[model samples]
Target: MERKLVLQRVVIVISIISLLFGSSPVFAELNTDQLRATFEDNSILFSNNSEDTNCSPNAAQRAGDAAGELVGEDNLKKAFNYFISKGAPKFVAAAIVGNLYQESKGNPILRQNKGSEPNPLKAGGKYHPWNPSKPAGMGDAWGIAQWDPGVAVLYWQQQAGVQGDVTSLEVQLAIVWWQLQNLAPTSRKNVLAEMTASGNVNEATSIMVKKFFGAGIPRTDIRAAYANKAMSWEPDPSIAAAAASGAATNCSDDSGGGGGTISEGGLNEEQAKKFMMNYGENKNNESQKAMGGYLWNNCNGGGSNCVSFSVFFLNKFTSTKGVYTPGNGEAVVSYLRSNRRVPTGKTPKVGAIFSWNGGRYGHTGVVLGIHGDTVIVGQASCSGPGKGRGDGTQSGGGSGFIRVGKINETKAWLGRLPDEFAYPEVDMSAVANYVGASTGGGGGNVAL
Candidate 1:
């Protein structure tokens, strides 16, 4: 009886150990044969485009001509071959080609309109001739993939070493690959692995559309059809075989720890709201000495006072002590990046530090809230209406009053605070006294 009891006790301990350290379940690789069969079954659901209509007699030549009109047949083939050479599956390359076709019909130099310049990176204003001397950011998208010429031009120049004209097919393709490899390496790896495993043009196209294109257009059916068309365009057999054999080589590793995960532990929503409300009330107090200058110091200019404001917020709310405060807005971005605090995407959340490149000093703000496409921010700057909380677009001018602004008109990067930081309980009577002492005249009265 004693031996049986001991045996039962040992079995329970072993079961508990297994539960604690068992391996996670692994998903099976998709079967290529099944994917092909499914695609064949769904062929009738695909759109009947020009490629489908002219599939006879000189089918190969006609298909080549169609691709040529967009980016030239040779360039299209080159992009496919390049992807395969880099160990990406042929299906993955085909998926990208499908998206490119939809974006510009394969034309590398295509602009939003017929006569506009290929480079859209110009100063924010009316579209005009390419000055080459002034800053870019004028019009809509341009290039083979219809990229925002303003932003795309900078990346192409700096990353790819492409100079002079920014409309070259080769340069655009390079930028595309660069973005996939760098911007979201984990997503890229997953897409590549899935495409290689399945060898399904349609599924690969869908993944690229969602992950790479940011869902710019809602034409998944059309994109799937295009991917099928691209797959029919044959590539060199040797390149395809090499790509298949080297499937283990990912274009890039997730060394930066997948860009999507925000650092854990910070102010929760309720705590953030409480802090902002207090901060806003303090901001409206004209008698407060900090209102006249940046963070209680009299430093007025066209430059932004965001760094000072951000530092004050961090010092007051979190347990962080003696935080380095840079006056320049761009410098603040550098500081956050150095600390590994930059968030992954442009989407704004409450408590995010928003940064943008605006002239010499740039601009920075703390996100108050995000509603649909607009982000509400608290900031100090020369461009918006002077001082006091507004939406994201308000200007701070020379006086260093806290202001709120609306930020859907421009692009901004975000930096998140370390997760371990949280709001601490502090006395609020000082803030109430500051507001009560205000003469009701000095604070900037910028309205939304």
Candidate 2:
């Protein structure tokens, strides 16, 4: 009993510490049980929502829940807003609430290792910080959704799969969203349809148990109660759309990964910085998908090359859109010059839309930072990581599937670089915000 109490205190302390760390993993603070649950790589992106938007935490605290007192306001709000942002209806979000509460009591970092139920968490000692650096043995379930069969780690942690704590509330929820939308086998995907079919919270709860969990239904009543409580926070329509369309970027602070917006037409330094910082932070698969939807709907950017990518950024972060002509990437530069939307420059500046006319199709990338000789640029192609290829192509140069590549970033310098860069009057950053050490798959410290 004393040990349980001690762990509970530890849980509270960790929660406060996590808040202080802001989107960074506090895995080193974990006891074995906690550490066992973590495995991460930034293959997909989901912004943090440590603070619930549109609604405040319900004051009716459920103190004895998972992770002890830390479960109530923080985790619940984070989980609900996260699912909702991914276009889940309230009940769909609520259903996830029902299932997760039953699975791990809303704890994003909960771990239960290879053991039959009744006495889960047998792998309590299996979490040696070094273990996650390798493949997890079969049967361990980790994180909020309880991703099972330790092998799931292979999928969860892509490039960094060998190691890391990708278990921020957003990352865990992104895992759930990724599973439901793309990764889950057919049966699990059906739950997304079924849950969205009706607002019947109880029915949705049952559906999650049978369809998503693939287990005998248990604790439907308690799970339903949690689901009901989750629905308490009314969501905002615009924010939901933005969350569904684009990955979160707090253009204002970049304090930690969470939902921050550019407020549409308020484009300038914030717009360029948001683009640069977010790409630096992640620029992963789902980041492409979520942001791809925005790129498509707004700028007609569903193509397979540089033109589509640059146009998407322009139509999105800039005030208005014009000249979304279809063709090789260089044509975009000509159109911009003809329209006089941006001034041409030889030296690359942070937030400049660079145009390379050397290649047949030409190429384009957005400048994020300047490290003296090298300009850190975010680019996309049906061929690179800044997000040009895969299924994320739909129309002229605007929207679709979502793929990112380029094994390593392509580097360029001032004198010869792209020859031309286009940016409104926005000076994203005169100096490097990515100086010393950094975190995130995209690198350095920036907002969520």
Candidate 3:
């Protein structure tokens, strides 16, 4: 009888502790288990006060419940808005939230707590420093996605100082978007396409879990259920569409009245900069390396060839038909002058191709940005680290790879796409803001 009384007291003390610190993993795990059970039974985890049991909860209602239990609703809303504002479909945003829910219970600062062992599987070690020069190893995972050391290092390197604190929801969300944009463009694009086509929350969540998170967790059913739960909370698609429309209008207004509208294929300075930066950053990417190699090998037929690389970016990003020629620098200038030229004396616009005299072929590169006298250009066949052929051979000058640099050594001729051409159907403002913030300034030269 005495031992039985002691056990009851101990149980009461433990229950009190659990209530006091609801964020404890012990409590979190317990709550998840109960939630899982509720899901399995097809019972509602939450309910309206009304008698309509059959009426499913909408996104706002579900979001409120999640806020009470996990991260605040405001943070989740910020993430959703960011994704939507950047052109992601609502379903895809919801899928990301679902993955975050499983990875860290929506806790941005949550770290892996496996144990006090040195091994990542065992947990409890110093978090890896955010450095990309070193290989990422199994270190204590941190932040919203529980990003392993390796992935975290790469992300940190890319964003550099913009990601002030890894634990902050703002930075974490930004990093997530950046990764989708740069590191996994193909997967991200495919997922967005699928979500747009199907508009199915379940399917989007499942695919995101498999591709985005690599099916990291074993509790696939629970994750899917959570994704469904998040779906009910997503902002209306019509609302986001309206916002995007308004943004486009604002962009047109801001670009002055006569330079042509974004919808009409006119490339603005910001849009052009964003495109050039992405190209420079991802030039050596697996998807782009072959094209880079082909352009290097075949575009000039082993002669001094830099014009093809510039033309490649122009054709890829703009609504213009890039000149296809194995021409010298003067030839490229002549081609631009004769075909849709923006005139020679006007200030060089962002996204304009700048041709400079070099040896026999001269040099050509895409004008990324022009800050006063400093003209930043993204060029191929330049000399620098990671800037040449995919096979480590130099093609034109320097390292012979795609790279960005500030040019002061050579006089340049400028050419722009026609003002009547429509810009790419993307939110250029968002891209501009993201790139500017990530790189620490608007005109600073970045490698990629």
Candidate 4:
């Protein structure tokens, strides 16, 4: 009799759960929104007017054109890379993300609601899509930028070419780009430069909040917090791109890092992370400070030099500190050729040291791993893009070590195609996931 009673109670509990969370009488389909809110953070962009937004495609759109929807940190990296590809400085990219995070926490497919918390990251009570005929009042806002009155969608719709997939980030961002460059009001045009050119990330965030997003209720502090976090994620300075190209103000393909796993050159992702925890980020600890001093004495840029950090990482990870290496990044390839007899080549391999020896110091970095066309590189330089031709280091307080991030594989990267990649002097020939060279040059060359 007791078991029977327990079964009845369990059935009742499940019925109640169904009423609240399941697709029962109360909600015809809550699961779809739930999946979208939780897993659909990247309904994403990349439409060639997808039959969508009418803005002329720029590098930002073209670079990310092949990417698909992703959530969390993945989305963050995509956004950062997208802006950097467009030649926006780190600050400009951060400002854009700051504004987006404020609006949708970086969710590309966000809709508005009339609830107390109108912009919740989850769909929840805020799943109201835009409807022009029945505006649905304040709850009818749409897009990552959240154009208001819900009726704003109508204006975008009327534009000749922007007709499909209203929720695509490609569509929305393209439209925003089009409006700013083409249709921005006089006030926006006046302040856009102030927002883009500000050296300080905070100042840029403030101007963006006031002039660009044009928020009815000001939240610069919160937006700036997100912006600052984005800034910290960068591997070099925004100005680093300027050094790479004749132009010193736009975006450049930066060598960046994030966490990755590989079993090559007697190194793994966790060990790479250990290197970062010990040497990278804004830890500002005594060890980091001391290492910075040591780097300054050796690499000549006070701990922020790429050669300094890459050499240090290779030696440490290979468990051979104070070992074979050159003074500047420019000599890394030759050093490998002469000393190690390992020829550097075009293809990137996990656990290889990549050198872009064209500029002054000729930037050098560790290839933590590779995913698709993106290469995760670790180097100490600026906090944005590496100055390809004139590649050098930034002074105090700028990000010097990037043990985890990613960069696109292009000749434009590191000023040109990597002169060559040097494998660490550890046994990786028979490792489970060991990667070999892809080039035709035969004999002793393990990986190029």
Whole-model lDDT values for every prediction: 0.40, 0.42, 0.40, 0.43
Residue 404, model 2, lDDT = 21
lDDT of 1 by residue, 336-447 (tens): 5455454223334334454565567766655543332344444554443333332223331222332323444443223322221112221122322322311111121000
Residues 226-252 of candidate 3 have per-residue lDDT tens digits of 766766665644445433432111112
Cα error, residue 163 of model 4, in Å, equals 6.7
Model 2's C-alpha root-mean-square deviation from the true structure amounts to: 17.2
In model 4, how large is the Cα lDDT of residue 386?
28
TM-score of each: 0.34, 0.34, 0.37, 0.34
Native-referenced Cα lDDT, model 3: 0.40
Cα error of candidate 4 at position 344, Å: 47
At residue 123, candidate 3 shows an lDDT of 27
- Of candidate 3, the 10-residue stretch with the lowest lDDT total is 10-19
Top of the candidates by TM-score: 3
* Model 3, position 219: C-alpha lDDT score: 68
lDDT of 1: 0.40
